[model samples]
Target: MTGDIAFGAGWQKTIRVGRDYISVKLDDPSFAASVYASLAETDNGDYALIWSR
Candidate 1:
């Protein structure tokens, strides 16, 4: 699956990492590089956003 995130006046693209997570690539004109992150559901039924350097 794929989607878009609204940032300011523009949109960023996102994709599904697996059956359990949705990944998003974040980028900006002022940033040096793009950042990747993923969101997954927790055991308690809440969602968690996971990222690494």
Candidate 2:
């Protein structure tokens, strides 16, 4: 799996991971869930304007 942060005003900035497996079995769902949980309370901490995709 791979992670990237992109900032410039316009873009998907999505998390991209390449693998030989099916897309449905992509990056750890648990991991993503943890991440979302951690950030959900940020309340715009992303307001720093840095895009972490």
Candidate 3:
């Protein structure tokens, strides 16, 4: 349940939360849905949901 995610390019960044979760932030609001969807694809019950604000 511990890993590192490199967002690669663009204005997005990832913040690691200890060894359990990661917080993704998108500077370009347009990529919110896309990013959320991508992360959601990897959901395996370890997480509740991939959300954006």
Q: Which rank order by TM-score, best down to worst? A: 1, 3, 2
By TM-score, the better pick of 1 and 3 is: 1
Specify the highest-TM-score model's number. Answer: 1
**Residue 25, candidate 1: how far off, in angstroms?**
0.3
For model 1 the TM-score comes to: 0.55
Q: Which structure is stronger by lDDT: 1 or 3?
A: 1
Question: Which of 1 and 2 is ahead in lDDT?
Answer: 1
lDDT of 3 by residue, 1-53 (tens): 98985553333334364234444444444454434322322345654446554
Residue-level lDDT tens digits of model 1 in 1-53: 88995532322344365345666667677667767677777779998877653
> What lDDT is reached at residue 48 by model 1?
84
lDDT of 2 by residue, 1-53 (tens): 89984321222322345212111212244444321111121345432222232
TM-score, candidate 2, is: 0.16
Deviation in angstroms for 49 in model 3? 5.3
lDDT-based ranking: 1, 3, 2
Per-candidate TM equals 0.55, 0.16, 0.25
Give the clashing pairs for model 2.
none
lDDT of 3 at 39: 38
Runs of candidate 3 exceeding 4 Å displacement: 1-19, 29-49
